[model samples]
Target: MVSSTAQPPATKRLAGRTALVTGGSRGIGRAIAERLGREGARVGVHFGGDATAAKDTATAIEAAGGTAFTVQARLGKAGDAEGLWSAFDAQADGLDILVNNAGVNGGQVRPAEVTPEAFDHLFAVNTKAPFFITQQGLSRLRDGGRIINVSSGLTRGGAAPDLLAYAMTKGAIDVFTMTLAKELGARAITVNAVAPGVVDTDMNADWLRASAEAQAGVSAASPLGRVGVPDDIAGVAAFLASEDSRWVTGQWIDATGGALF
Candidate 1:
């Protein structure tokens, strides 16, 4: 039994805000962009070379009663971050949330087998891009804004030797989170990292959905007894973007489905 006057709860937590999600065309980035859009933030869907995917994400956001636009830049190239921001500036006046979600796995290669070329490229996109992106974004990022860096679960341990280089990048992200949190405390901005494990996105479809045994093994790896989805991590990113996380910063939130702990 319910009263006719009972109203629905509000879903718009970020009304009048603007967000930029790098690599927002697919997977966790897409999910985060959509989630932020749902919260009422006008999202800038940044994609490297996927115009269709980027447009689809923006269209989906608009269809859901939110606002969004697309920005493009091939990360790891010269002036990539600057190019992204330039395009972003033409669309939005300022930013309220910056989700540094673009990254690469650098393939599965051991330290001994890793090449200098691969290593440089990996750091360029995974580490260097975000660092300078944030640096350049400071002027546009409003006070009390949020900066969320997407990280990986491999940073917690060195068990995955094949991902040694990739894991190192996440470690740098974690450190960036802490250092930036401290530096931006005066302005009340919150900086944090969300590390996910074995998420069932297209990036992992090759192995994750390859066989029942493979899927079952991944599911069993997490104490929650399931593989993670993009939305699983998106929910966390939304929280960090919202005012509800005002007091939280410099934290490496494990959105890993209890895989490490």
Candidate 2:
């Protein structure tokens, strides 16, 4: 007999939809792709140079009874968006959700230590790629599609001075989210940004994984009393991709565990 508290088998909320998540080979991108796949969307897990991790993410999605395929394209270069969409078109007809989750942290370059080349590359991958990717993808993205841009809490200020350039890119992304939402509203599509704080990922391994004291310090920065995980951000993306967020757009949803406050 079914227990009163036991829920029914999960329902596929995104059945028959198609989603493409860049940098989906690991970390938050991986979690987002897997979550979307579990909700029944055929996921395109895009990776750069990491075929093994991409395959692993796809395998995990399939193992969980979802359909997924890997797409490879190195962002931050010329024609990167075209290459990505060409690969995407080979597998799916159109897009229902586009998660621009790929980016670089620009290392630890302060204002005095920053180089022009480094700054250019940071914008190329973090800002320029997503801008054009979405531009070209507008035709393939069906009316009412969801476009989720992964921003950062650093844009809100109060972060390290060395992250200045990185924060600037995210600031641009926030502006992109607002303007695109207005432009795409006519088609019922939603454009929004999710700004996550210091998440526990390979990107921050030098500090977060260094020692217990460092871990405690990072965790204490958040009111939640713990480091943010990839899944913590993925849960927010899933909500934005669903019908429930149809009424939400042109906004930056801070997933910073109250660090911004």
Candidate 3:
């Protein structure tokens, strides 16, 4: 007779898959990397200059019964994309998921204050890097794989003018997502963007945690009545990376907790 004590099987939606997450050492990238690991994906936790943090993220993934490894390459520089992929290929034979989550904010500078150098740097890291990185990865990314880009709600408007250049970069990503989705559809690959509003991460801690009033102000803007956390966006990324989102290609998923409304 079969025993009645049989437990339910564990959930590992991404088992036998491999993923590479840029900037996976901290903030939203870390959260996405960890989540993907938890789902049974062997994660490449990529960092720019923070080896320790990348190691920590990989360690956390392993501690949670998942596989992870750290890779480093400072983005926005020449040869950065190739370097990142070389490091990735050394660990994994091919990739199934690619999360382009690394970027810079260009400080709160407005149009007049924006320098030529600042503009170029912003586009290099935020737009050009992802474009080249994806181009390079296409050969390594297997058929039916997923490419999820981290975008910004600022692209939808209502954000401060200070974020103009930054938003422009994300807007380009939006277009890239749609067009690339069409190009890769024959291969069954899916491309999409995840746009998040102001989130409570190290990136925003300086201002979001400046005062109770400041925190409250941001929370009030969202119907959810709280600032979004990295995990909130991570959940959406995980979904996009999973088989569940097979039919959801070329879309901009709003992970902003109704802030845009």
Candidate 4:
């Protein structure tokens, strides 16, 4: 006897998984966090500051029928990675997915104008933080888990000269991704990088929306005739975090909507 009111079950690919997304309070990080939450992962939304934003992100996840918590820690400082993990430890016993998405653009400093201070800051947040974070997180991350790094399309050719320092940091991330994937292969932990091109996030809204010309220029850059949204990158991150990406490792996925091509 089939019931007339019977409903189809919801899909929760990440059910029972625990994930931590750095900078998850906003931008692409928030998108990834929300998507993972929808997939049924108990997500730890990490933020540097802006407790309010972090709370909002957590609320959004919970509102969507997912479990979420907030973790606050300022990265790029001494012992920052350890402190971040400590905060996460207080809430969750282990981690199944780690997304290193926190980073800074280091302004628009060209190679000639780049200073030692700016370079250090850029590398600290974009490179060193992720490296040490991963080092400390390995203890908490369970085997067969996932590690997804948010890289930039600027690391590829045709990048603007003004983005030299910023791109260098992401370049290091690419190397880190390949090397770490090899090292972690024994544990069945897949490591990959998701490279996005000119995503329309709050960070880029200032310039990207400055004028119709600006907007059109960006849209035209992609063969798809559109600018990328945070969800565009999130979808790729979600795939990398899921069991479906088990065989995909050590690859730098281009999420640029064919802009590079």
- What does candidate 4's lDDT look like per residue over 1-261, in tens digits? 111122223369999999999999999999899989989999999999899999999999999899999999999888889899999999999999999999999777679999998899999999999999999999999999999999989988556999988999999999999999999999999999999998888888778767678778878878888788887888899999999999999999999888898
Deviation from native of the Cα of residue 115 in model 4, angstroms: 1.5
lDDT (Cα) of model 2: 0.90
- TM-scores for all predictions: 0.95, 0.95, 0.95, 0.95
Residue 250 error for model 1, in Å?
A: 0.3
Q: Estimate, for each residue in 77-98, the C-alpha lDDT of model 3 and write its tens digit.
A: 9999999999988889999999
Kindly report which residue pairs in candidate 4 clash with one another. Answer: none
Whole-model lDDT, model 1: 0.91
Weakest 10 consecutive residues, lDDT, candidate 1?
A: 1-10
Query: What is the per-residue lDDT of model 1 for residues 1-261, given as tens digits with 9 covering 90 to 100?
Result: 111222123389999999999999999999899989988999999999989999999999998888999999999999998999999999899999999999988767888999999999999999999999999999999999999999988888444888898888889999999999999999999999999988887877776778788778877877778778888888899999999999999999988888886
**Candidate 1 at residue 124, lDDT?**
96
Candidate 2: tens digits of C-alpha lDDT, residues 202-233: 99888777878877876777777888888788
The predicted structure with the larger lDDT, 3 or 4, is 4
Query: Per model, how many backbone clashes are there?
Result: 0, 0, 0, 0
C-alpha positional error of residue 73 in candidate 4 after TM-score superposition, expressed in Å: 0.7
The true-structure Cα RMSD of candidate 3 reads 6.1
In terms of lDDT, model 4 sits at 0.91
Q: What is the C-alpha lDDT of each candidate?
A: 0.91, 0.90, 0.90, 0.91
